[model samples]
Target: MKINDVILRTVTKIVVFIILTLSVYLFFSGHYSPGGGFIGGLVLASAIVLMYLTSDIETVHKGMPFDFKLVAALGVLIATGTGFASVIFGKDFMTQAAMKLNLPIFGETELASVVLFEAGVAMTVIGVVVTIILSISEDE
Candidate 1:
């Protein structure tokens, strides 16, 4: 059976972009506000899920071409690395540092190590969620 899904695919493209943009905003705003790595990662995973829902796993994989397991491992490595970095510097584990730098684009921008940690967390969430979804889908 040839099912017609032109409208769904068209709308998905736009919706996915919006979701990804929102996810990025959520991630960046996390340090100062309610949103953070966990929520942002959830939102990101949702976007990926939406893509899978719109089409077959094979098709989505063609576009994304990601090994989710590796993604998860890398995320863990990154998150743990940040913590170990503190230890290497003779500080307690997971100790965070921040600094302010003046730049031509954004003046007096504050950069912190916590952002890296959050990024790791976000990547982990995305990988694990997608992997679980794929596993369940395969059961059918």
Candidate 2:
């Protein structure tokens, strides 16, 4: 590729990656604060759409290989399972899971089901987005 094309491609990749990372962070943070899974997932999915557009089929096939689809599925399962947990316990949907945390560097933390639900949402959002992008990009 020409130097100009190479520069453009690199910049594009960097920008997309930054946007994707920020979205994931925002989605995760939103669980405690203002953000939540739906918006976060959509933001993540949109970034993947950009990636699908910018990349060729071969590149996407090699890089992701449908893994995102599986991840998204797992995320849904987790979220759904959380609901089930509440129902089984005769509590409301996504009642706190009563969990413990070990953050390594940050040390221990208190974890709750709502936060876990957010994690599931974050994964689902990121995964579904990547999956959609790959599928749509390939369709083109």
Give all candidates' CA lDDT scores. Answer: 0.92, 0.74
Give every collision pair in model 1.
none
| TM-score for each of the candidates | 0.95, 0.69
* Model 1 / residue 29 / CA error / Å: 0.6
Question: Poorest 10 consecutive residues of model 1 by lDDT?
Answer: 131-140
How many angstroms is residue 30 displaced in model 1 relative to the true structure, after the best TM-score fit? 0.7
Give residue 134's lDDT in candidate 1 (0 to 100): 86
Off by over 4 Å in 2: 1-4, 67-72, 88-90, 98-104, 126-140
Q: Report the C-alpha lDDT of model 1 over 55-118, residue by residue, as the tens digit.
A: 9888999999999988988999999999899999999999999999998988889999999999
- Model 1 TM-score (2 dp): 0.95
Best by lDDT: 1
Q: Please give the lDDT score for candidate 1.
A: 0.92
Candidate 1 stretches greater than 4 Å from native: none
